[model samples]
Target: MKEGNDDEIWELRLYVAGQTPKSVQAFANLKKICEEYLAGKYRIEVVDLLDNPQLAQGDQILAVPTLVRKLPPPLKKIIGDLSNTERVLVGLDVRRV
Candidate 1:
């Protein structure tokens, strides 16, 4: 699932507060998307806001389940349970063939 010959890596951060239903769903959805689209070219870091609330400020997280694309420049964010694959792909600027 590498985008091109550049060998670029997709750095994603999932911010959640404890193991709520939404948080769990978001993580599951994200993993599915990455496995299908990103494969080995992606890295997911799950950050529990409940454990470290101060980290939220750096990312400006305002919700329970927020997906942050930290690498590849022009950082992007998608906030939700991430049940919509098409929307998630669009939000991450990923075009499926």
Candidate 2:
């Protein structure tokens, strides 16, 4: 198994509105995916739009429950509840071993 080094940290930001069902589900799914694939190499920052509406414009987030990969360059964004693990993995460019 190929393990990621401490230097390769995955900076992820999940933008949501309050604690809506979709937001909650997105967070749960993201956490599961990170734990399974990223392990100790990922960091998730949950951004509540309701609390800081201005944050949305910086990322140009048009929808809720959006997951943004900030680190590792070529920033990627996934919009949805993240129910599809395959899609999430692909979108995040995660290679399964």
Candidate 3:
């Protein structure tokens, strides 16, 4: 399901405190975005801080429901439920084609 000439895989890391409403929404929004824009070229790794708090330190995540782009270099981060598709795409610097 890969698309375009860009063969670089998108490595996304989602950090959440627990199964709270915000965390749930973030995951849903992220999933939808990835499916639409990234499709099969992306991989999402969800990390629950409540289960393993130490994981947050690796990404320097200070807030819950934070999305971190671990690959494609220049690591990018977005904080929120990710309901805003345009902002998320802009923050990730992902082009729409």
Candidate 4:
């Protein structure tokens, strides 16, 4: 099962406000990371908090532009504008230490 875990697909949810500069940059950075590393093995669900603020509670989101890693166990949360791609990637367990 150890081998299976490494190859498992990733599920990521990015919470953001609509059309904000930070949100746009976050998406761009996330997209690049997914393509460069996770590739087709990941899914990013961008949530607009402006529309549904309630969704934040499920993940205990305290801030906008938070990225939550929901799958593959040991769920992790990263808060910010996703200004740091490498940091976010590592925090999400998409890249090893």
lDDT of 1 by residue, 1-97 (tens): 4354347799999999999999999999999999998888899999999999999999999998999999867799999999999899888877644
Candidate 1 wrong stretches, greater than 4 Å: 1-6
Off by over 4 Å in 2: 1-6
Please provide, for model 2 over 1-97, each residue's C-alpha lDDT reduced to its tens digit, 9 standing for 90 to 100.
2244547889999999999999999999999999988888889999999999999999999999899999877799999999999898888877542
| C-alpha TM-scores of all predictions | 0.92, 0.91, 0.91, 0.87
Give me the displacement of residue 58 in model 3, in angstroms: 1.0
lDDT of 4 by residue, 1-97 (tens): 0123547788889999897998888888888887777766788999999999999888988887888888777899888777687797778776666
Which should have the higher lDDT, number 1 or number 4?
A: 1
Roughly what TM-score does model 3 have, to 2 decimal places?
Answer: 0.91
For each candidate, the alpha-carbon lDDT, in order, equals 0.90, 0.90, 0.90, 0.81
For candidate 4, the lDDT comes to 0.81
For residues 4-91, could you state the per-residue lDDT of candidate 3 as single tens digits?
A: 4568899999999889999999999999999888877899999999899999989899998999999878799999999998899888
